[model samples]
Target: MVNIQKLRFFDCNCSVGRVAYPHLSDIPDVEGLLKEMGRAGIEEAMVYHTVARYGHPPAGNALLTEAIKNNPRLHPVWVLLPHHTGEMPHPGRLLPEMEKHHVGAARLYPGANYHNFSLSEWCSGELLGALEEAHIPLIVDMDTVSWEDVYKILDNHKQLPVITATCTYRNNRYIYPLLEKYDNLFVELSRFMGAGTIEDMVERFGSHHLLFGTNMPQYTGTAAVSLLTYSAIDRTAKQAIAGENLGNLLKEAWK
Candidate 1:
């Protein structure tokens, strides 16, 4: 049995993309992040790129890859801008990079980067098919895009495990329906704290569909950790959300 309280945490949502705001720019450095994670009982994390403006997606990806390369406690999630250049990057090349870099997943920010929603023809079946073949889960920012559009995107790729980032109280209405409709839809609990959001999601989707996430830098890691550590869910359920779910998903993919 998994020990919920003692479980390691894997933050599925994080971005070092681009510092668009001064507050974001002043966030803790990697060492500080590790200290915070240790304080919050997080044993490991899967982080993505945030420097969107400097080199677009690839720059952020490179930065994160370098930062986490030596940190066994951290894992890299590669960022891809399918809508950039008005054409998807060659999957053959991109997938190999992810594999070479030991990236565990692929992150997309249609709303954050102003890309066409995943439902767009540009983000075609071929692109998704490649991701599936490569066994990488797709992480998206649901808060930025419309739920209807996200749903349509999921409809086209039902077999893909789609994780969402930056979820908040406002998106619960959309979240509930999507969780109910698609077994592959999973949400990272980051911005959706206090507000009874975790309780509500637990009550509906149970712990299986939820994964622990600290928006980190954007939202205080302490607050996000508190939400899960203080939740009403049982220890087993908490364990699943905090780390087991993500671990299980990754193991399945790697196998």
Candidate 2:
């Protein structure tokens, strides 16, 4: 049996504040979020504000920055949009803001139901290029973007580290090919609950690209942590998926 405590999980997909559509378990404040993390033995988390997704990115980003200012364990993730619409600052201004606020990652909501923007090169090439050049990890949810768009983004920006968050077992076929092709691609473990799926992926592609995430407080951290606890992979690989891989990605962004 694996020792869960030794893994030191660092969640990569989390949010703070009341979402526009919130589950009963959603955590709306920093204190509650910290408490929940403590209960799950999660040492750190990269989080974005609900407002950043449901409201305005700048306001939500600012709110998240302030909320996590005193807490080193909670790193802020800023929601980004294509700058052409002027909904967000251009990449030049945005990148500096990220550095100033110590934001660790950037997220995109390009679905027709949400941000209503295209991820095509013609729309977001400048911002994508800047993120690629800076080595900042770009996170997108499979629900928020189509597999075709995901492929296009990965194909266009080979060096950009792109993490697909909230992935499910249904995504295996799509995710597998991407993993096989893109070394910079990563998968966040939240809703990725397929029996023996973790073991299978590790066996096939290795554990370096599998990241620990809870999707909290929309879901529980226990499920994701349990996946690692019972996984057949060796200790070192478990440790990497639990936290080391995410730490290394953030370190690269800071560099």
Winner by TM-score:
2
How do the residues 1-255 of candidate 2 rate in per-residue lDDT, one tens digit apiece? Answer: 884346888899998989767667657998888888877878899999988888888889889988888898999899998888787889999899889888889999988887888899998899899999888999998878888888998999998999999888788989999989989899998888888888899999999999999988777677788788788889899999999999999889956
lDDT of 1 by residue, 28-86 (tens): 35776677677777788888756642346776777887777788988888767663464
**Would you estimate the TM-scores of all the predictions?**
0.86, 0.96
What C-alpha lDDT values do all the predictions have?
Answer: 0.72, 0.88
Which candidate number has the best lDDT?
A: 2
Model 2, position 229: C-alpha lDDT score: 78
Query: Model 2 lDDT vs. the true structure?
Result: 0.88
TM-score of predicted model 2?
Answer: 0.96
Q: List the residue pairs that clash in candidate 1.
A: 16-49, 16-50, 16-51, 17-49, 17-50, 17-51, 17-52, 18-50, 18-51, 18-52
Badly placed stretches (over 4 Å) of model 2 are 1-5
